[model samples]
Target: MQRRANVELRTAYNAFIESKRMSDPASGLTEIPALNQTLKPHQHDIVTWALRRGRAAVFAGTGLGKSFMQLEWARCVAEATDMPVLILAPLAVAAQTKREGEKFGIEVKHCREQSEVGDASIVVTNYDRLQKFDLEHFAGVVLDESSILKASDGKTRTAIIEAFKDYRFRLACTATPAPNDYMELGNHAEFLGVMTQEEMLAMFFIHDGGETQKWRLKGHAESEFWKWMCSWAVMLRKPSDLGYPNDGYDLPPLAIEQITVGVDHDRAQDTLFVMQAATLQDRIKERRETVEERCRAAVEIIARKPDTPWLVWCNLNSEAELMTKLIADAVEVRGSDKVEDKERKLLGFTDGQIRVMTTKPSVAGFGMNWQHCADMVFVGLNDSYEQLFQAIRRCWRFGQTKPVNVYLVAAETEGAVVANLHRKEADAERMAEQMVAHMQDITVATIRGTSRTKTEYNPSVEMTIPQFLEAA
Candidate 1:
């Protein structure tokens, strides 16, 4: 009986693989003559999976063309299924998706403006705006940077899942879905109807406690995990599995060095208290937000140096707002800007007309090719390794001439945290160890789920102006 059961299981698995290979054949099939010119191999894998599988995930790395894959997959599905494809993304990136379609000669129709979506094939909108639009009207849906919805209970995430529930075809794309742990995989699987968190735990996971249900590793969990993923998601690394298009071009040798900047004792203590302990108290309010002093320093760095294009990475609206003091035309690409503005900014940077472009790593990282500047300053830290690498690679790319230099700016103690990030990143190339240690906490929270802690920065280290200037 056991032998018979094994045979049946193998047969079923083979059937699933067979069914997943063929493309959809329907009356709606309309092929763009220019499709072949733009689609890359990994993108074709996603396109095929979308047409064949009922639902799937395309977990391609950043800078490896996920937006293009999502748009192209949606276009393929639209032709076969004859329904407009709805795409949800972070605001800065959602605006850029429509233009990515045009880069391949595919056009996106604006569904929100119209009373009814027509022969028009593709529609793009942000996750926040997805609620206002009727999601069921579309035949299929694609979620870009799907990790943004990992917190299962958030209004946007719930709205996204509910909206796409009835679609015949559904797909989600992000570089690192489980940047921290296994359970982050649950939401995507549930969206695809492959399994629910409850079902996945019962079938493949070892759960803890009767109430909160945290995950501990099941035996052979990693192997089983990858095998199961074969039916639903595909992940790839760049310049390893896929060769670079500009391999022939000479890239500048990158020299990464660390310089510890010293701070005044009083300022150091205040900053340190603000970063570490001040947040623990009620009366003392701690803020990591920049003051005019840092802006002045960055400006001096730019002004004193001649003709060297500098890219400054900063968080918070006010931090970027200060850059105009140094750069008369400092520009920012936030998740909120329209797609055209992003395109203009990239063109300006490429032409050296825009000297400084302050940005968040996740939004501005992937779609733009910025080989113009060989210098980068990480004014802030994001938990994901993929976002950070994508931001730095803008200059570290193949066509770069001068050796790339990356300056990661942070409070002295936080410098340890930032340095650990780069070392962890370097190891990622060898072992393909998918987990980023610090990020595991957020992923664990999603898996087990607890009320989130409120956060504030109490700078543990501080510096005086004269001391900081002399070091610089």
Candidate 2:
């Protein structure tokens, strides 16, 4: 009897895992001829990447030419597949997207109803009208300002995701897809069919609190989750992240000034000491009590340069009304305004016809490009850092030649709101840095990763059996 020797053979477990990880699940969509010559180099690259992936999300920052990228993407898909592409935009953004398309010689039909969308190569409509059109008619869909899918009214979000589920090509474009909460990313994941929101939560996250749907990723799953995200999405704050030059995209200097008004403690509180707002109701009470003071302070700042273009952001309808009346040339757009009126006034402001425009960020903040205006005033504060950032960026984005001025007008007691906003801003900045740093190289790799061809294992070395094994 002799001892037997063991022989080892290696399997392609690493190769199989790598291949499956990097493989794109999309139906291979063919690239079309260059649809737009006017696209910046980075814009061209993004469009090309979307074309290859078939379904993707471009989480580009404000003023990074997301509109241009989206338009070109729609154009490419429409041309390549010879099927119409649908673009779902925020209110007034459809018109803006149409204009962006024209610059590149791509014709975009802005539609309010299905009848208005006839025979168009690229159809642009608001998200609210998602149910109006037949989803099967279009081969591709693009969601401009895609974060709107996370709106509290989950109906629209659910409709957009389910409506476009069968479409061969899909794109979700936005500046903030997951602004503060990671759960927001679930909407994108589900919309793109990369993974269902429930599956994503189950795999990467857990119920953070005992009684809330609030999800925090499992500590060990953070890296794996981000890597999974990059397989289907690309988030870049600037072109430089994708190895493109950022020469013309540089933002001008931003000058933010805080204007504090003395609160009449007797009115807001019975005691001598005015306490800071600690809750939403308290903040609302403070805002209601001091709308006049905040607006008046904002009005004074605007009056200094009466001829200059200014954007005033208010949180309450009352604030908008007071500011519009107090400022002789101001126009206010409220939530109750007719759709036509809202579009007209927003376009009017964009065209420089309106010297001063007053509106809540909820009404006009998401998509309009107001680079023509260099001055802005925040008449009050809201808890949403996204709204605050969007409102400021309406003026402070790229293409503004002058330094942008932002005035934050708040009452003394609203210090808590202002401080909270500042804290959120800092947190957002840090999150953005982390997101970019984590995604930049990985994003480049993801794009390049998908194009990789799997290397087949071919061993040139001849293997010999062990003498003991051969004897056996």
TM-score of every prediction relative to native: 0.68, 0.88
Q: Per-residue lDDT of 1-472 in model 2, one digit per residue for the tens?
A: 3322322322343445455442336553554475577778777767777788778889988888899888888877887888899998888888888888888788999998888878898999987788788887899999888878776477767877878887778899988765457767888878877777887788788785786866777999877777677667778888887777889988889888889898876764476688777778887898898988898999899988978999999988899899989988899988888888988999999998999999998888898898889999999878787878888878787778889999899888777455677788888787677666667766444563335212223446655555766577
Which candidate comes out best when scored by TM-score? Answer: 2
Model 1 misplaced stretches (Cα beyond 4 Å): 1-38, 110-118, 151-153, 206-216, 239-259, 267-297, 300-309, 316-318, 332-353, 361-374, 382-390, 393-404, 426-472
Residue 110, candidate 1: C-alpha displacement in angstroms: 4.5
Against the unseen true structure, what C-alpha lDDT does each candidate score?
Answer: 0.59, 0.79
Tell me the deviation in Å of residue 436 in model 1: 16
> Clashing residue pairs, candidate 2?
none
- List the candidate 2 regions with Cα displacement exceeding 4 Å: 1-24, 268-270, 416-418, 443-472
Scored by Cα lDDT, where does model 1 land? 0.59
